[model samples]
Target chain A: MKWKEKDAAMYLAEKEYVDTAVIPLMPVTAGKDMQDVVKSGEFIRYFTEYLERQYAGRVYLFPAFTYIKTKQVPEEQLKHWQELLREEGFNHFLFITSDASWRRTSADSFGELFWIPAFSVENMEVQELAKTMEQQVQQLVPLMMDMWQSEEK
Target chain B: MSEKNHRVSRRQFLTYTLTGVGGFMAAGMLAPMVRMALDPALEASGGAEFVSVGLSEDDLSEEPQRVDFNVEIVDGWYTSEQSRSAWVFLYEGEILALSPTCTHLGCTVNFGTNEEYPDQFFCPCHFGRFERDGTNIPGTPPTRPLDVYDVEVRDGMIYLGQINQRG
Candidate 1:
């Protein structure tokens, strides 16, 4: 399910089946790295959208948690979001981002932080973008399965 | 002589010209209104069309494989391309394509993924299982069989159309 009104109704009706909450963490910066920030945000948006489609039954894709790029990770705000989602009955939390700063910081406490190297997709054709994301999603599926498996134990 | 014999009175000429011009003006004004009223009917009904999945007969085997394809979707005035996937394999010497969407909660099901659910499509969401032929296993979340795509083979290439619910 997605962060849409129709999907919200379905999610409420079948909350048990939809246990995973996916949030794309995007950084907004007006610095010298503005282009890079936009590129990574674009990639993360598309990546999470595809991931939600693949696992729509189980994943409730939340709107991206956007924050200003900073040296220190916003640990408190991130934890608050996680707590709210957990209280809302989402058992698994997956946070995907293309920002390297997230990987540098120990943000695993927030949730499963999925950090991918940012790739420029401004010039990529639609067909090529789909192929690239499909390949990456193939690798991501196993990671999610592992998360689900480990939690079961 | 004939023109004089069939002489048209000034009043008759005026009436005839007025009726002729008025009829032409009325038709011109109503033509656009009629077309606008029937515009919806004139439009081609929105139906799913066959799209090539970039797979040939040689790619199929007994084991089902995921095939991805791009479809052009038009919603209102916006046009976009969407990527969709299906599981394709050879079933009883015939090409078979099944939609990956699980009937229970719309999760993508994979074939031969879990060791416990071997030889079946397994939904990771709720452990829903379907048989090789996409029949929902008893006690699974799915209440019905997996949807079957209308398959067409042209030039040895596989093209899939709209999905039909397996009754």
Candidate 2:
């Protein structure tokens, strides 16, 4: 399920089924050369959507948490968001992003942080973009499964 | 003389009025029955339309191969194409096409992924495993067997239809 209105309504009625929440930690840079940051945001959206489609009933794909990369990392804001979702019965929180800087600042306070190196998606062909997305999905699946199994234990 | 000729008989007027009202009442009573009789003809048939997954008989072996195809969905006013996948293999001279979606949590299952179970379908989401025939292993998260799709072989191509839950 997604964070949209229709899916949220269904999630409320069947809250017991959805235990995992996926949040995309998107970095939005202001002023100087914002092109790469925007591209990373696009990639994160595509990857998260693929994850949601694979595990629709069990995972809730939340809206992206946009934070300024050039400025201070909004750790407190993310912690607050995590607490809110936890109260709403989300046990597993997976934060996916292409921003590497998050690895330095994020303390795993919210949940598991999956950071992949950002790449230039500009001027890429459709087939090439799909191939790259497939590769990323293949890599992330094992990591996601490990987290889920550890939580069960 | 003009008044007498112009005046209609009471019997004739009553017969005409009764026929008109009774015919309308009879037609109203039969309308719903007629609609019910024609309803099945208007609806799409129960037989599902098969879609080619680009897999041939020669490609199928003892091992399952993942085949993806697009299925057109018409939901009211919105029409869109959605990609669906299945695991196809040949067993005992018969073709079996199983849905890849896990029965436990709807995650896509991989074939021969787990080292412990070399020939079973493994779901990474909850560690669910299915036997070679798509039956859920005992003590696994999945309660039922993986769904199987209706398969048809036309000419030299393999076609798949709606997925049916195991009985």
Candidate 3:
């Protein structure tokens, strides 16, 4: 479910079924790397949107957690969000990002971090971009399934 | 005296012809604009069209296989291509296609994914289970059976249409 008003109401009603929260971690930086930062953010946004549609039944897609790369510490800020989501009863926390630095954060009790290399989709055709993202998301599906399978034991 | 009244004066003739031409011009400009405004409502409310799922009918077996396909959905003025999946297999010597969406909470169900429910569709989100024929097993979360898709085969390829809800 998305963070829309209608989906929010639906989430409240079916809170038990939707136990997973997927958050996108986006880095905002301004400098010589502004273009690259924007590109990566765009890629992550598209990737998460596609991912949400596939697993919308059981996952709540939260808005992107944006933090300035140079001005703030992501770990502290991200923990605050995770704590609030945990309080809301999310069983699994999946953080998806193109920022590799997130891997340094120590794993939380219930949260899992996925750091994928940012694919710069600067000049691709629409059809090609969709096909590429679909294939990439397919590879992540198994990893997510494993996450759920591990919890069963 | 009667002929003089019947003959049209130049001023009267110009007034009549100009009014007639002006009405035609106004209608000509308004017709397309009106049609454009009503284009959405005027469109045919057709049934769901069959989309090729890129699967061969010959490959289907008794074991249900997940086939991912794309559908073009138009909502209001926005049109998008969405990826959807269905379980396709041979049932009773005929091709059968079933939607994998769990009826209870809309989770995607997998075929034979759970060890306990081998040969049945299993919902990972909650423990919803459906038999091989898409029947929702009693005591499962899903209240209704899995939806069946209208299947079409042409030139050895399989195409699936809109889902038909089952009681």
Q: Estimate each model's TM-score.
A: 0.83, 0.74, 0.76
Q: Who wins the lDDT comparison?
A: 1
In lDDT terms, how accurate is model 3?
A: 0.85
Question: What interface RMSD does each of the candidate structures achieve?
Answer: 1.4, 3.3, 2.9
Best by DockQ: 1
Query: Candidate 3 has what TM-score?
Result: 0.76
Q: Chain B, TM-score, each prediction?
A: 0.73, 0.75, 0.73
Q: Which candidate is the best by TM-score?
A: 1
Q: What is the DockQ of candidate 1?
A: 0.67
Q: Please write out the lDDT profile of model 3 over residues B1-167, one tens digit for every residue.
A: 76578689878999999999999999999999999999989886646899998888778899999887778889779998777789999999999899988888777788998998798999877779999999999998899999999999989999999899999
lDDT of each: 0.87, 0.83, 0.85
* Residue-level lDDT for B2 in candidate 2: 64
Q: DockQ of all candidates, in order?
A: 0.67, 0.35, 0.35
Tens digits of per-residue lDDT, candidate 2, B1-167, equal: 76568567778889999999999999999999999999989887655689999988888998899887777888779986666789999877899999998887677888998999989999866678999999999998899999999999999799999999994
* Consecutive 10-residue window with the lowest summed lDDT within model 2 chain B: B1-10
Candidate 2 residue-wise lDDT, A60-146, digit = tens: 999999887865677778888899999989988888888776777753766988888767667755545555666887788777777
Off by over 4 Å in 1: A104-106, B1-46, B57-62
Tens digit per residue, CA lDDT, model 1, B1-167: 65667678778999999999999999999999999999989986647889999999888898999988888889779999877889999999988899999999898889998898789999988889999999999998999999999899999999999888986
